[model samples]
Target: MPKDTMTAEQRLQTVIRLGVPDRVPVDPMIYYFAAYYANITVHELWSDMKKYEFAINKCFNELGPWDIYYPINPISPEAYMFILPMKMKLAGLDLPPDEINQVIEEEIMSADEYLTFARSKTPTTFLKYINFLSTLACRVQREQQGEGIFAKTRIIRKMLKQIPVWREEFKRWQARDVAVQHGICMEAPFDTLSMSRGLVSFSYDLMDNPGPLAEVSLALSKGYVKVGDWLTKKTGVRRVLVFCHRTSNDFVSPKQFEQHAFPSLKAIVNGFVERGVTPFLHCDGNWNKNLEYLYELPKGKVVLQFDGRTDIFRAKEIIGGHCCIFGDVPASMLAFGGKEEVTEYCKKLIEKAGKGGGFILAAGCEVAPNARPENVKAMLDSVKKFGYYS
Candidate 1:
């Protein structure tokens, strides 16, 4: 095979532009798993990030040398940074730090709040809820951390102090010639609604009160663009990470997806593309029936990343040239399968989804906290063995 002829960013951008690069880039989304793979608890990763960085580098040098650096978030992810923030059973707070956290799936918005939300012309109504929730969060923090008046103040102070950790992560990765994977994070409005109203209630709302839900979703997508744009300017990274799972074909019927999900999602995606920023969608569910719908997006401007739930092979058939595809390696395989089992699956992925261009090899969603190191190494090494292009 020929030696690499492009830089890491060049290779990634090549796929983004719908062109073949020297090789396929591997971009595993190693979130809490990073802490797990290193035998460090998730909470420890957030609390002592320099330690996190060292362990991550060790993973790369020993088992990885993977393309794209997944940044150790400087800000604690447990905090309220979501576009449509809602209560969650956060790790290290409501649950064990290392255990998978829950979304609570409880209702925050009542049935009556929908009309008022849609009718209001300004963001004041939205901000009012956010302010109320934020204050509630402060008390939650104070109660969880301590009982003193200055307890909340002390905890808030510590959260702000982690910004340097992210800077260090970025600097270290850039210095090492690895591409950093981070940007302004946002979510699809419909998904937010599902979580806020609870899925069962939201499904009823979809049936009986579709109009307001649609209107609220549209407004939230627009709001996301505004917030994402401002953050992009501040961060100087021209990428937007949009998390969309509730709209997938497996979650809702095709007709419902097109009606309630696709429109608002397309609006948010195109909104970012229009502003010259790339929207990297973190698709969290099966999207088989919705693959054709993705072609409605601007050609070569957006990335449709899949978890294991999506059929990546058929996806390559549908949107190969129209958009870049990332991921589909099952986390189960990484955490349980033998090295040979993992390697065979990866080779299959390379031969099929990677035959042309516009493919990124990554764990379907994220590397599991209990993923076998040998299996991860096998996944990482497959690219070097079979990923190169002539």
Candidate 2:
């Protein structure tokens, strides 16, 4: 067998820089499926950080080599609360043991509160002002709770404990020769505000009151560098997940996006690059129109990952040269299709999107909790069969 010329770290780095590597990097977003494959229950993962960590390591080692690992651990629900500030009902509580988490969006932050959150442009002040998520939960507690406005809340205490735990998880992925994905994650300020205000209320705000919304989002954009810095300090990894589910063209009109979303998006993306952090965009909807705007971001330092909703092939035609591309292997096929079907889809992606240097093969979204094991393997296998470079 021919030997790989670059390490996993080097391989991913090359692709992000828009340079050809030994092969197209493989980043299977193996999430809940890892637990099911490893015979661990979701409840166990929520209760024990050690078991959650063990399940992840076992999945990679036993399933064999996987290049970039997201390791979206099941234990820490608060990791997300800091950004979106919405209640997430995770599995093993009111939900079934193996079920995925759900976000319960309500009007947690009133239209009246927007001014205060937008003021400091600092999360420390904003989070204190917002006072944690509306439907707050802790896996350790397994019940709903509330926190009042304060200098510091219980969530900070919980997150501090998680830092040591998350650091070890990153180390384990490294031992397996897999480069861990973002050590920290971010959300577009518009998505954060839209969800926090509830969809109905947010829509009304968009139509009825556009001024404050724009002001707060742009102000929120200024603080992302500090947020990334703080998160990088805690996790000791430089890659950041800048998730964009609601801000895509699918969710809002182009005019609305241009006014409300784009400025903040640009600020945060550039903010990360200015601080020397790689921003991994987990764009979850049809971003066909938005792809045209991404070229303005720092070339070769940003990665755009789609969840099968966007036309990834056209995305390759569009920003494939300007930024590294990741994902679009449909979750449905991985769960219901045969290995041949999965392989053929991957072959197409490898041949087309993978034609150039800036692409990483990954599931269209999170690997479905029930994806066929053989199909998951096929996604990885296709890379070896068709992804080599001269």
Candidate 3:
């Protein structure tokens, strides 16, 4: 739009391609805050498709100038029954409009069940859907009381009607030249296990029953590739965000991670790469111990994004010029730090990570609900002031 060397989309693509762009792209992970700013309850945003689109567009109008636009959560109606099985105040129909949707993390499968899944010839989708429905039923029972049946039917109807609407919304965003729509999001196998089996249970499984856990991890990795392929075909986007949370150093020792996490992660990355999609690794938490393993994956085909927990500067030194590195601005700073504090910190981040061409400026994680709008403004402003390649 400004007649720069690259369009906003091109600017982001340049960094993703491991080349320096005319300026560093400003991309932040945004979620609940969108509804917060739009003056709508999270329930309305996720339950009603039309309102969801309106609120997201409102967020774009109000907070943007961003290179990449990520429509975080309440992805689609089918997503409710399939990809996300969590039930909370806003997500489940019986709850109040003000209640927030939350991911229900419980070990739905026993240790032997994991082994059974690994050995079964059944389609992973069938298994996952069955498990999701079971979990949803359980949630409905607990939260819906007598209204469960009616509420569930209403929610499903709403979702079914919105499928086409959501597709059209994505098409409209894709037509916009100023911003790139983020593609499909997938999680690494280990993280999937952590979510399916509560962290405590998964931790125990890892230590007490490593064999079944490893088998299940491999099975999940294979399933993810199939899922990624399906999503790529469905959405026509070739980028996948492979979220890896529990695999971080905060949760496991180096040996445990190498044994259980790295193999499946490698498989998933390779599987996606083989299918002609770029994998963007959202490796949250302290991954200092596993930084070296990232190098083992194919170069220039992956973008590594870190939450504030990881030492991104060290990451820059380890993989900086070779791979595109996305963030580390503490969410806490964005939430409580003054404008000047935010500005200075951003400047330093740019000077260090933006020195080469492959860094994108962003908060370590999602800009929290309490994050000051002025601080966010400061973040965008700092990029304009210091992120230029000249």
lDDT score for residue 81 of model 3? 37
lDDT of all the models against the reference?
0.74, 0.78, 0.71
User: Candidate 3: which stretches are off by over 4 Å?
Assistant: 1-3, 75-81, 84-96, 123-166
Best by lDDT: 2
Model 1 stretches with alpha carbons more than 4 Å out: 72-74, 77-84, 121-168
Write model 3 residue lDDT over 1-390, tens digit each, in one string.
233577877887788778888888887667666677777887777767677777767766776756676655554444553343333334445566655665556665456667665666655653542333343444433344332456556555544454455455656776775454345665576776666677788888888887776667777676677766766566656777777867899988889888888888988889888988788888888998889878888887788889888888899999886778888778899889999999999998899988878888887877776788788778877777888888
**Model 2, TM vs. native:** 0.92
What clash count goes with each model?
0, 0, 1
Model 3 residue 205 lDDT score: 82
Query: Candidate 2 has which clashing residue pairs, if any?
Result: none
Q: lDDT of candidate 2?
A: 0.78
lDDT value for model 1? 0.74
Among these predictions, the greatest TM-score belongs to 2
Query: TM-scores for all candidates?
Result: 0.88, 0.92, 0.86
Error of 1 at 367 (Å): 0.8
lDDT of 2 by residue, 1-390 (tens): 556788898999999999999988898887678779888887776667777767766766666468998856635666546555666677787689788767786766779878876664444733432332322222223344544433135666665676777788788777767788888876777788887788889989989998888888777675556666677768878888987878877778888888888888888888888888899988989899888888889999999999999999999999999999999889999899999999999999989998878999999878888999888889987888889986
Q: Is candidate 2 or candidate 3 better by TM-score?
A: 2
